[model samples]
Target chain A: MMWLFLVTDALLFAGFLGGYAFCRLASDKPWPDRTQVFDLTFITLMTFALITSSTTMASAVLAARNGRLQAARGFLLVTALIGLGFLGMQAVEWSHFIHAGARMDSNPWGVPGFSSYFFLITGFHGTHVLIGVVVLLLTTLRSLQRSNADELVEVVGLYWHFVDLVWVFVFGCYYLV
Target chain B: MSSQSGVSSYRTYWIGWLVLLILTVGMVFSGAKPVLVGGMLAKASIITLLYMHLMHERRRLVWTILLGIFLTSAVLVVLSVPDGMAM
Candidate 1:
C-alpha cells in the first residue's frame, strides 16, 4: 500500500522529465548550457540542505519505530525546518531568475531548451516540495494524536526518502550533465 | 539458502553516493567533459538503483510492477531524447 504510492509518484515525475526531454530534443537548435546558467553554488547548497533533512527524517522515523514520540517530533520538526530552508533557497533562485528577466517566453541563452526545461521541470519539483511540506505538517499533527507512531513515521519516511531520490536525479539531469 | 535471495535481504547505502557528490563538484571545476558525463551517469544510476533497491525490499508486487514499468520506459527513452529520458 505505502510502496505503491511511491512508484506512482515516480512515474508521474518520469512523465514530466520525458516531456522536458522531448521538447529539448525535438527543438532544432543547440541545447542550453545547463551548468553555466544554473548557479551551481546555490543548488549545490540546496542539495546539501535537502540531503541533511532526509538524514534527519530517517533518524526521526527510527526514533518513532523505537517508541520515542517526543524524540520523533523533535527530529521531524528539524526536518521541516530544513525543508523550509531549502524552499527558501528555491524561492531565492527563482527571484534571481525573475529579476534577470528570464521567463518561459524568452530564452536568454538563445536556447529555448533551458528556458522551457527550467520552468516545467523545476515547477513540477517545487510542487512536490509543497506537498512534502504539507505532509510533514500533517505528520507533526499525527505525532500529537498517535499512541504508537511507528506506522505514521514509516509512511512519512517513505515519502521523505522519495523526495530525496527525486532530487538526486534532478541534480544530475539539471546541474551536472 | 541460495546466494541471490540472501543478496536481496541485505541492505546498505552505497559509499559512492558520497563520493559522487564530491566528484560532481570537482568535475565542474576541472573542465573535463568525460568526467562530467561519466559522473552524471554514475550518480543517476546510484539514485535509480537505490530507489529500486528500497522498493524491492518493501513490496514485492509493486517491485514487479515498477520493474516492468521501468523497463518499458527505458525502451521508450531509447526510442526518443538524444536517448527516452527519465520518463
Candidate 2:
C-alpha cells in the first residue's frame, strides 16, 4: 500500500533525473565542475547540520511515543533550530553562487543549463527544508501546550525525514552530476 | 509485531542516517569515485524499506512522500514558469 505511492513518487523523480541526465549528455559543453562551484566546507557543514536535524527530529518522535512531553518538546525545538540553520546556509550558498555569477540565465557552464537545473532541483529541496522547519517549530510549540503533539510530531517527522531524503538526492545530482 | 516494527524502523532510520552522514563527509572533498550514485540509491532504498507505512500509521509513509513529490513538482513548475515560457 505505502509502497505503491512510494513507487509512483520514485518514478516521478526518475523522470526528472532522467531528463536532467539526458540534457547533460546532449549538450556539447562540459558539465560544471562541482568542486569549483560549491564550497566544500560550507556544503560539508550544511550536510552535517541537516543530518543532525534528522536525528533530533527522530528523537523527538521517539520521545513522543514514550509519552515524555518535555523531552519531545526539547528535541523538537532542537530539530527546528537545526532546520533553520540549514535554511540559512542554503541562503548563504545561493548568494555566494549568485555573486560569483551563477545566474539562471548564464554561467561558466554555458546558457544556464547547469544553473537552471541546479536551482530547479536544489531550490525545490530547499523549499521543503523551509516548510519542514516551520512545521517543526509549530509542532514543538504545540507540544509545549500539550495538544495533538504526538500526531503532529509524527507528521512533521515524516516531513523532516523526507527533506533529508531529498538532500541525499541533491547531493548526488548537483555535486556529482 | 507493531512494537518490533516500530523499533525496527527507528533503528533502520538511524543506521541510514549514519551512513548518509559518512557519505556526506565523503562528498565534502569531492571524493574521486562519485559517491553520489551509491549514496542517493542508498537513501532512496532506506526510506522505501523502513518507512513503507510508518507515516502516522494511518495509510503509509509512501503516500505522504508522494504528496511531497507532488508539492515539490508544483513548486518546480512554478519556479520554472518564467524561464520555461521564455525558452
lDDT by residue (tens digit), candidate 2, A1-177: 323433464555545655565556556667777777888778878878887777777777777777788988898889888988998999998998888888876886574678877777778778778877777877776645666566667666766776776676666766755
- Indicate the worst ten consecutive residues by lDDT in candidate 2 chain A: A1-10
* Model 1 regions more than 4 Å off: B1-62, B82-87
Candidate 2: the clashing residue pairs are none
In candidate 1, the residue pairs with backbone N, CA or C atoms under 3 Å apart (3 or more residues apart, or in different chains) clash, namely A14-B87, B77-B84
- Candidate 1's docking class is incorrect
Reference-based TM-score of each model: 0.79, 0.75
lDDT of 1 by residue, B7-80 (tens): 12112332433654675577567646587657655655554444233433536664675576678579657766
